[model samples]
Target: MIVKMLHDAGLRSEHAYLGAAASIGLSLASWLASNRQENLERADRWGIFVGEWAPTFFGLGLALANYERTDGEQLIDSQ
Candidate 1:
């Protein structure tokens, strides 16, 4: 249902995968920024919080990929 909704909403697997990648980058950036501005504990918390999003995005990407494969939309191109 979520995959269908995402598809209907025009969100492809690549978008989720890109979001996952961006989340990782954001996690690092957040950690660095917090470390510089705040402290190690805050930085760790920020990193952990942002880092957790990657898996959810990756899971959504996988689900969308499977949906695309079964539905034959080819929304995400192999490259």
Candidate 2:
């Protein structure tokens, strides 16, 4: 139901996928930037924190893609 609402509200699987990819890039960038100014542990923590978001985004993308496919199937079946 939540995925359906998100889809209706203009959130697509592609967007989620892109977000995941961007999160990965951001995580790498943050780690590189923080490593220069902070201790290894702190820099690793920053990367880990940002890296966690990628899985959530990837999950959302999968859910949205499944919802879109099912929704399309329903439409075709109804016709």
Candidate 3:
């Protein structure tokens, strides 16, 4: 199920790169916004947390998808 989700989201290098890039952008926005306001810590926290997760998710997606292709199946490396 997770593999299918990643595949449908275009987990190739191109998409992974995009996801990572987006994550950075979100993180920046989160940080900047967090520093600008005093009553929006939750929003800032949410954005920052989610943003941080994006890069890792995209990176894993890339590695798994590539592994799948190399193995001629959706078999990701266990390393």
The best candidate in terms of lDDT: 2
Question: What clash count goes with each model?
Answer: 0, 0, 0
**Model 2 clash tally, residue pairs:** 0
List the candidate 2 regions with Cα displacement exceeding 4 Å. Answer: none
Question: In model 3, what are the clashing residue pairs, if there are any?
Answer: none
Please give the lDDT score at residue 49 for candidate 3.
Answer: 88
In model 1, which range of ten residues has the least summed lDDT? 70-79
Model 1 TM-score is 0.89
Residue-level lDDT tens digits of model 2 in 1-79: 8998999999999999999999999999999999999999999999999999999999999999999999999999999
Error (Å) of candidate 1 at residue 21 is 0.4
Candidate 1 deviates by what RMSD? 5.1
**Full candidate order by TM-score, most accurate first:** 2, 1, 3
Question: Which digits, one per residue and each the tens of the lDDT, describe model 3 over residues 1-79?
Answer: 6655666666665666677788878787877777677457776776778688776867676776675677565345554
Give the runs in model 3 whose Cα sits over 4 Å from its true position.
8-11, 39-48, 71-79
Using lDDT, rank the candidates from best to worst. Answer: 2, 1, 3
Residue ranges of candidate 1 with Cα displaced over 4 Å: 73-79
Q: What is candidate 1's lDDT per residue for 1-79, written digit by digit as tens? A: 8789989999999999999999999999999999999989999999999999999999999999999887875544432
Candidate 2 worst ten-residue window by lDDT:
1-10
